[model samples]
Target: MNFKKIMQKSMGFYFNFLSFVNPKKLKKDGFELFCNPFARKVKPHQLEFLQKGISDVLDLEGYQIQTYKWGSGSKHILLVHGWASHSFRWKNYIEHLIKNDFTVYALDAPAHGLSSGKSIHVVLYAKVINAFLELHSEIKSIVSHSIGGFATTYFLDQYKEHTIEKVVIMGAPGEASDFFDFYKETLGLTTKSLNLIIDEFYSQLGKLPSYFSSAKFAESIMVPALIVHDKNDLATNYYYSIRLNKHWKNSELILTEGLGHDLKSKELVKQVTEFVLN
Candidate 1:
């Protein structure tokens, strides 16, 4: 077998074997690993382009998150990147927002970019956004990619006082349960292990993953939203965006052909700028 298959088999064996010896401990450990995965390392070259921004770190709860501020405009916009992503991923969007006379703020989630952590999840990711909003309440719009999109909705659902005028969710999963399923499948988690992990998650988070649906969160948000999903996206299904658009009362859905997950299209960028500003 190849490396991936071998690793999957090894994980299955390890979890199954541990279930007999110490199931409780295995559940706890597995849940932690499932939730707090090792962050993808940021490359050195990525930092070279970030030299123009004002950078700072925020110590929140158990995480030290890195944030960047660009532009001097009074009105502010926030850019949120997805899993395994850093603030630098917003380079293109930042330029557009700046050109439109909006100050841009981007953050490296806990365990991402310059942040100090081993693992991160949507709940913690939402907390990071909350922390930033606490200080910069003037933020008028937020543009989020992938998991960050779901986290943004989750934050808006909880904190309604913040006056966010517009939102853009790019290539995000609709349901939190789908993500958990993907996680289980990716790690080759046994049924028992999956159940135990779910139980552990409930115990810690006070809700099942199903309760944290992005579609459900969108239902509660009254602001205008633009959801961009490429039909060929492999990581997240395009149908999820369709479902989300249906739930969001005031929203527009843009379906693209070959852009896939990471949208680098200047046309899409222009569309986003028009949607947010005009």
Candidate 2:
């Protein structure tokens, strides 16, 4: 973490914290979209071309799936966006991947983009990914950022590798527990209160679900993994990615400097695409 990313992550945290206290800032993160009658980021970008392609596929179960055909080849690459972001967040990556002649799947997770949930958790995202893999058994690669990166591993833990051949987890935390802890601090909830809330959340579903830790799952991965993490990713705290790489068996790490938690660097995207294709 040089001077720039430190500053950016600091600002993002401060702003996110400010919103947590003020409630108005929560809207900035798209929390109010539940109450609003209109669509947010993912809805507007559900172009005719994308919608028509997914309509021929399996049902969303809880959310909508969008697709775009890149080339005649059958090598499919699934692209997942991060927290508070939509499939459109991968606009740059999608275009590049498409130009490279690979089938692209840019999904909108539940409660995000064009999905139907009012809110979301890592489990739900993993479920959606597994279901999609069940329907399309040719997903050759996965590229996920931040929370979605965690979901990629969660999906693996849930269904035992249905489609994904290899993956690139960019800026994803090594553990969901850390993010949950961060959520508590951001929400001003104590550990006891957080546990109570999570317990209630679990009870609503009628069961306790097992979570995936990237650090643990990395040791069990049979496929290749390349983690691209910036040293300055404050949201995830660079140590998480380092720990994952340490545990992973067939994995490589690409350490960066400028990029923070966003993981939107073109160089990182290109490297990930290359790793997947190779």
Candidate 3:
């Protein structure tokens, strides 16, 4: 087996062993490991775009969330990238937004990009979104990719009333529970370890993963939104966007093939700009 497979197997064995001796400790350990996302190394080109804007940091809980700003339009737009992704991923999108006379703010979610954190969860991601929203109420729209879309929808639903007028969700997963399944499969968790880890999640979040559904949240949001997904996306299935669109009364759905998860086509940029501007 390769190193990754061997590591997963070892983790499974270790967690199972701990479950027999101290399930609670096993749960704590597993939960911590599960909550943290793997940080990817920043590329030189990514750094170039990240530096194009004025930079600042927002002190959040125990982490420092890095933010970048471009343009000086009074109305602001927020760009939220996905899991293991940093603000620089939206560099091209930011260029398009700026061309439309909109100021843009891109943030490094906790544990991603230059943010200081070991890991991040959807709840914490929402907290970060809310913090920036509170600090910059001028933000009128958001463009989010992958897990970032989930966090943004959660924040909007939980807050109810907000200044946000438009949102674009691209290749976002449908439910939080799906993440647990993927995590369990990735780590090759034992049943005991999985149960313990799930229990710990409930203990901390005060609810089960089933309670956090993007489709459910979308049902209540009246803000105009554009849900874009690629039929061939391997990471997040396009079906999630279909489900979200069903309940989002004011939202539009754009399904594309061949673009895959990173639907960064100039055509998509044009559609997004038109929807948000509309």
Candidate 4:
């Protein structure tokens, strides 16, 4: 077997064994592992690009969130990146927004980029977005990718009072259960271990994993939005966006054939800029 498969099997064996011996420890450690993201080192180009922006840090619930600002236009925009990704992922989008005279803002989500955290969840990310919005109330436009898109939608749903004008959600998952299933499969977790972890998740978040659905959140968001998804995206299925679009009354859905999940292209930047600007 391959190394990754072997490691996954080993981890499954360990967690299953722990479940029989000490279920409590398995719940705590398994849940934490599920939330923790692999650390990504900043590249030289990414660092250089990030250095051009005005930098600030916000202390929210003990996590230090690193934020960046660029441009000085009257219209403001925020860029929210995907899971395991940092603010640097928006380099092209930032340039496009700046060229369009938009005061662009971006943040490295907790546990990603320069932020100070070891683990993250969608609710925590929504709180982080809320904190940033509190500070920059003028920001009325948002462009988000993957989990960032889901968190943005959640923030909008929870905090109804805001100045948000337009939003772009790209390659975002519709259901939180999708992640839990992926985690279970990746680790080859036993049903008992998975159930224990789910219980821990509920104890911490006060909601079952299936309760956190972007489609459900979209139902409450009235802001005009553009939902972009790739038909062949292996990370997040395109059907999620379709389901979300049906619920988001004022949203538009765009399907691309082969852009994949990241959706990084000059054409997409142009389309998103147009959606936000006009």
Candidate 5:
């Protein structure tokens, strides 16, 4: 087996053993492991790309959020990246937005890029987005990928008062339970172990895993939205976008083939730009 498979097997064995011997410790450790991003290494090119934009750090709830801005257009736009990803992922969209004369903003989600934190969850990420939105109420357009999309929808759902005009969500998971299911399957967690982790999650967040559904959150978000997903996206099933689109009322759905989760194509950039501009 490869290194990843070997690690998964070892983790499964370790957690299973802990479940039988020390259920209390298993809950704490499993919850932490679930929240941990594994911290993707920042590439030199990515760092250089981020440095090109004006940079600032915001201290929010004891976490330092690294933000970047480009262009000086009267209209403002924001970009939110997904799990295990940083702002560099928005380089193509940023270039396109700037060329269209948009003042673009992007942030490194907590624990993902230069931000300070060891762990994160959808609720915490939503709060981070809320804090940034509070500062830049002029930002009316947003483009988000994966979990970033989920957090954005959640923010709009809870806050209910904002200046957001348009939104674009790409390859975002519809249900938070999907993440827990994936984690349980990947680590081969025993039922008891998974239950312990679920309990711990509730203890920390005061909500069940099922509470963070994007489709459910979409019902409350009344802004015009563009939902793009690939039929073959392995990271997040496109069906989630289909489900979210059905409930989003003012949203449009674009189902593409072979683009996978990133959805980084010139054509997609054009579609997103046109949607934001028009």
Candidate 6:
């Protein structure tokens, strides 16, 4: 390589190293930085539309932009957005649910949007679902994404009588234990930093910070699950989908190439409709 190119590369590395070592960056807690473009890592335009829909549905006059909701019905469907995402991310899916005559609810899990709190995990996320289910009834199915997919597995383990009839897991995880490890590697977080994150997470909850592998949940869960994932998704990868199929008692897995992590569309609508009807 040319000397100029080598020097530029060295400077780039130094810049990144300096940023990571900055004390100011480390001292600020999770909530202090409620919405980081880097932390969230993703956003969709549909969020605005969905936020408006939520207000219209509730006939609310104010706007803190509550990104979660309990649809006005016993029989219903649900869509769960991923980590650092607002529930409004499911606008396309919501339209399909309404068109198919399904009352739908979507949750913007803690720290993602209007929901109170900071960064969250599958266990706490599942607890929110459990809390909602206890009050509601006739929940028909779920269409969940990424970490939302992992959280659903936590719920499958907890519910005994199978209140959830069907589930469409889009880019879900197969092994919860592996999730944070992936986060660690992707963000270059040391074991010490990972432990600190877990500690912070614990301070926020009674549940432990582990969403460990529950192949048992898949095997024992009677709900019909459809695992939709992209082969090229750098986030969760495809292993989770394969594992869901392997362990699930009644699941159909579809592996799509070139789609990456965001796999919502007309195809998703059709597949979701078929699963709910069946």
TM-scores for all candidates: the values are: 0.95, 0.76, 0.96, 0.98, 0.97, 0.72
Could you give candidate 3's per-residue lDDT for residues 166-261 as a string of tens digits?
Answer: 999999988878877986787777777788888998999998889989988887799989999999999999999999999899988999999988
The better-scoring model by lDDT among 2 and 5 is 5
lDDT of 3: 0.89
Please identify model 3 stretches exceeding 4 Å from their true place: none
The TM-score that candidate 2 achieves is 0.76
Among all windows of ten consecutive residues in candidate 1, which has the lowest summed lDDT? 34-43
Q: Give me the runs in candidate 5 sitting further than 4 Å from their true place.
A: none
Q: Give the distance in Å from residue 96's predicted Cα in candidate 4 to where it truly belongs.
A: 0.9
After TM-score superposition, the amount by which residue 201's alpha carbon in candidate 1 deviates from its true location, in angstroms, is 0.8
Model 3 residue pairs with clashes: none
Deviation in Å, model 5, residue 207 alpha carbon: 0.6
Go through the candidates in order and give the clash count of each: 0, 0, 0, 0, 0, 1
Question: What does the lDDT come to for candidate 2?
Answer: 0.68
Candidate 5 global CA lDDT score:
0.92
Q: What TM-score number comes out for model 5?
A: 0.97
How far out, in Å, is residue 163 in model 3? 0.6
Looking at candidate 4, the ten consecutive residues that score lowest on lDDT are 33-42
Residue 139, candidate 2: how far off, in angstroms?
1.5
Q: TM-score for candidate 6, please give it.
A: 0.72
Better of 1 and 2 by TM-score: 1
Instruction: Tell me the spans in candidate 1 whose CA falls farther than 4 Å from its real position.
Output: none
For candidate 1, report its TM-score.
0.95
Each model's lDDT: 0.86, 0.68, 0.89, 0.92, 0.92, 0.64
Better of 1 and 3 by lDDT: 3
